[model samples]
Target: MYDTLKDTYQLFEEIGRGRFGTILRAFCPVSAESVAVKIIDKSLLTDETDRACLEKEPKIMTLLSPHPNILKIHNVFETEDSMAMVLELCEPETLYDKIAHRPLPEPEAAGLMKQLLGAIAHCHRMGVVHRDLKPENVLFDSRNNLKLADFGSAEWSGEGGSMEGVVGTPYYVAPEVLMGRLYNEKVDVWSAGVMLYIMLGGIPPFYGETATEIFEAVLRGNLRFPPKVFRGVSPAAKDLLRKMMCRDVSRRLSAEQALRHPWILSGGEANPMD
Candidate 1:
């Protein structure tokens, strides 16, 4: 099976590795283009539920295909030994890399958030929820535009527009999720809020020495912005953050609502110095 794929694509150069498998930057001779191949070992699929989840990924990708901010899958191939998914090649760095040291300016952060919201909004529009929406899962292109990747944890909204389960990274999980409450696409909204906070403050709104402490803070969701840190930030930017991080599910802004926020509408362009 690997040989068959080799006939079409020249797989080389390891780019990323994870528990199940590794990602390699490969080239297609026929298309004369470069692509990323996520090869997962079939042996890891021994668990019935695990195999089901992996199978669901291709379906979810098809549901949101061609969206500007969602990563695109060119093809999927399952072989006797492994599963290969061919995806568009995004630039190497991610949001996690860009703001690793300090937060970006309000205007800059808004610009990026707008793109992020747009992507998630598209997914929600299609009734899909990206269970894991963290900076590490978001990749940027050469142009710095954001692309939401890794639908591995994604699931359909299902009946009633909500889902049940405890999934997602600790820091970004919605408070409701932490409470073991039912959730929907709005969970992604919470993640975007956490991301917005990190972008502007250079740290997550809820943080603790351990994952449990972090979970406790998220459940509390009693977050605040220190004036000294946000001193020069614009009012509209702060307002949007407040709206986004609202703990109440009903009060929290949806992806579409977030996009319409004044700060986002302004393109996050008003420099703080003004």
Candidate 2:
């Protein structure tokens, strides 16, 4: 199998690594382009959740794909020891890295949010929910187009529209999720709202030195914008943020509704004055 993989694509050095696999740069002779090959060692999948995600990711990506913002998966290969996924090669830097430098201007942040919500909307429409929606999962291409990646934590919401599990990052997890209640696709909206807050404020709205403290803050559900941090952010943008991050799931904005927000429709130009 290793020899077959070697013969199939011109695999290069490892570009990234995680607990389950290493991402390698490779050239696909068939496609005549560079691609990222994620090779997951089956032996390392120690937990049921991890194993399920490995099986589900490829199928979910295939079902919800062909969207501009979602990362494109080209092919899949498997063997007794490992599974390899051929994917579009994106820039090494993630949105997390980009925001670490400085807060993005409204227009720039709006552009990214537009792409993100579009992808989320598509995912929900396909009955898939991306439980993890952090900036680290968002990638950029050479042309600077946003590509939403990493569906390892995603789940199929199905017709029931409710799922149980305490999954997601502390800073971005929704209140209902923290309470161990059944949650739906709105979990992604809460996470995206947290991303927008970080993009505009350069810090997560809910913060603490420890994960427990962060979780506590999240449960408290106090949404605020410090004057110094949010003075320059437009009111329209803030309104959308509030809607997205609302603790009450019923009041939270769906990705489709968020797309129609004046701030988004105008590319962050609506109500420019704070």
Best by lDDT: 2
Residue-level lDDT tens digits of model 1 in 64-132: 999888888988888877898898888989889988988898778887888889999999989899989
Clashing pairs in 2: none
Off by over 4 Å in 2: 272-274
Candidate no. 2 TM-score: 0.97
User: lDDT of each prediction vs. the true structure?
Assistant: 0.86, 0.92
Model 2 lDDT per residue over 70-148, tens place: 9999888889889998899999999999999799999999999999999999999999999989999999998999999
In candidate 1, which residue ranges exceed 4 Å CA deviation? 271-274
The pairs that clash in candidate 1 are none
- The Cα error of candidate 1 at residue 234, in Å, is 2.0
Q: Give each model's clash number.
A: 0, 0
